[model samples]
Each structure stands twice: as C-alpha cells, then as structure tokens.
Target: MRKLITDRRLLFGYILAHLFIFFTFEQEKVFWYIFTATMLILISYSILDETEQRESRKFHLFIGILSGALLYGVFWIGDILIDLLKLPLSNQITALFKLFSPELTWHYLVLFLIIVPGEEIFWRGFIQKKLLTHTNPWTSIVLSTLLYASVQIHSGEFVLILAGLTGGFVWGILYAWKRSIRLVIISHLVFDLLLFWLFPLR
Candidate 1:
C-alpha cells in the first residue's frame, strides 16, 4: 500500500479524481462522499511519502503569513471589482458559501484541517517534487500549477478559474522556493479563512 501510494502515477490519477468529483458531482452529500474519500487517499499517501519532510522554519512561517495577507488583499480588490463590474457569477460564489457554511464546522474542519493540508501535500510535496526529479524546477512548478488550476475548470466561472490559476502559481512558486509544505499549507489555510469566512467576496 505504501509503495503503491507513493508512486507519482497514482498521485496524478488522484488529482484527476479530484477534478472529476468536483466538476461532475452536484448533490451535496455525494460531493462530500467523493471529497472525503479523495482527501483521505491523498492524506494517506502524504503520510506514506516519507522522502519529503514538512519544514517549520520560523522564517517560512513569517513569509507564509505575509503571503496570506497579500493574497487576501488581492481577493479584496478582486471582489470589489467583481461587484463594480456586476459579473454574473453568483452560482460560483454560492457554491463556495455553501461549502463553507456554518464556518465553525465546515470552514475550519474541511478547509483548515483537510483540504488545504491535503492539497499542499499532494500538489506540492508529491506532484511537483516528483516532477522536479526529471525536469527544471520552474517547469515542474508551472506544470503542477496548471494542473492545479485545471481541476477548477469545472466551476464554469471565469473568475474562479482565474483565481485558481493565480493562487496555484503563487503557492507553487513559494513551495518550489521555500521547500516547505507546511508553510504553503498554512498560507493556503489563512487565505481560505479570510476569503471564505472573514472577508467573503459577497
């Protein structure tokens, strides 16, 4: 099981699975079923991929927090622009709010504990790390970033897709530079907290 999960091919397959479930599933309960299943698979693989270590350097932490703040600023500006422009993307926004409903439970548990950590582990720690072995670091980061954004294509919202692409690149570049999965994960968690709960675009 460990060997199987550690393979990059398996990780890529799981990435596709995330996209499939995210785009195709509509029923909330069904979505959660696949979401929880995929998250567990990725989390298990992350634990078993022992070649990488999740660093917790203080400098990385500081940078991570700063990165989160910067991302929040971008979101704030973008939200204002969206409102001013009257973009008809409410369905995309509604999906996000529903996913993070009753913040104490959904946002904290799902976003903070599971999704963010799992994503960083799989996308950065595993996928990009594997790609780096055979390609230029920047190339690997960019490819992984594109794949990261690809999953959100099913959102059927241009703004959401743009946000995913931009955020993936930022986080991907940070992970490539810092080599800190924990840092990227924390940065992502902070950004999600601010975007979804504290300063929601709505």
Candidate 2:
C-alpha cells in the first residue's frame, strides 16, 4: 500500500499512460498521430525501466502465437454473444473503430510493428512487472488490468474499456507465468494482427 503511493516510477509511468491515452482518444485532431507518438514514448520508458530475460526463443514464439489465436477466438465468441443479446454496443464499437481503426497501409504496419509491441512492453512488461514485486500474482494482474482499463475511460466507450480489461488480464497472466517480455510481445503482436487486420471486430 505504501509502495503504491511512494513508488515514483510506477506513478509516473501510469500517469504518463493516462495522459497519452487520453490524448489519443479525446483529441479530435488526428488519432493516429497522437496514438503513435504515445506508443513510442511509453515503449521507450518501458525499455529503460524493465529488465527482461531472454530464454527459449522458440518456446516463447510457439506459446505466444497460440495464446494470441485463442484470445482472438475468445473475443470472437464474446462478440457473437453480445450480438445475440442485442446489446446496445453497436454504436460504441463502431465509434471505437472510427476513432482508432487503421485505414491506411502504414496504420497496420505501425500497429503490428510498433504500437502493439509498445503496449505489451509497457503495460505488461513494465507496469505489471512492477506490480508483481509489491503483490501476489493474482493481485498484481488485477491491479494492472484495472490501471490498463482506466486509460481507456477517456474514450467513453464501455466496450473499449472492457476490451482493455480483458486483454490486459490475459497478458498480465502471461507475463507473470513466463516472465518473458518477448513472449507477451509476440502474443500481443499476433492478437492485434488478427483483431485489426485479418478479422477486425468492428
């Protein structure tokens, strides 16, 4: 509890995440520009703050890809369930895509190569990793998930916030289990690949 208030790096990183993410979602100027900038900055900070171990390259790739595919499947089912229930989330989902979806070729490129990696490295590799040092795995994962979801609140889209919570929980567990930044990064990369380009939810 004391660490949560006194840890400067944790507080600074989360506060920065909120500012950047809020700018990405709320600014009407241009989404990609702000979003890309945010990722770059956060990723830089993560790399400097987190020290990750490199081990079992092939195993990480295998599990990461597999988990990503499974995660996407979970979302697909969730999407179907939401549809079946006739939830009033169509507009919110559509708005989420409109505001942040990749249209141009480079948008996909950046999302895969930079933005996804940036998010995984920062949120899971750095933030969650920090939380683990101060709490149990379950508690750390939940805390990280909440902080991760909180950044999406400025979007004012419940679905988007929910997505953040769900995805963050998965990645948080992966990081805690494997303690490999590469593994989670690969998982995130694969998940975004399917979600954004191959089979977008919206």
lDDT of each: 0.71, 0.85
What does each candidate score in C-alpha RMSD?
4.5, 2.0
Per-candidate TM-score against the hidden true structure: 0.79, 0.92
For model 2, residues 156-194, the per-residue Cα lDDT tens digits are 889988999989999988988887878888888889889
- Displacement of residue 40 (Cα, Å) in model 1 is 1.3
Best TM-score goes to which candidate? 2
Residue 130, candidate 2: C-alpha displacement in angstroms: 0.9
Candidate 1: regions farther than 4 A off: 1-16, 19-24, 50-59, 99-107
lDDT of 1 by residue, 55-87 (tens): 536457788888987988987887777668887
Candidate 2 residue spans exceeding 4 A from truth: 50-59
Task: Quote model 2's TM-score.
Answer: 0.92
Candidate 2 accuracy as lDDT: 0.85
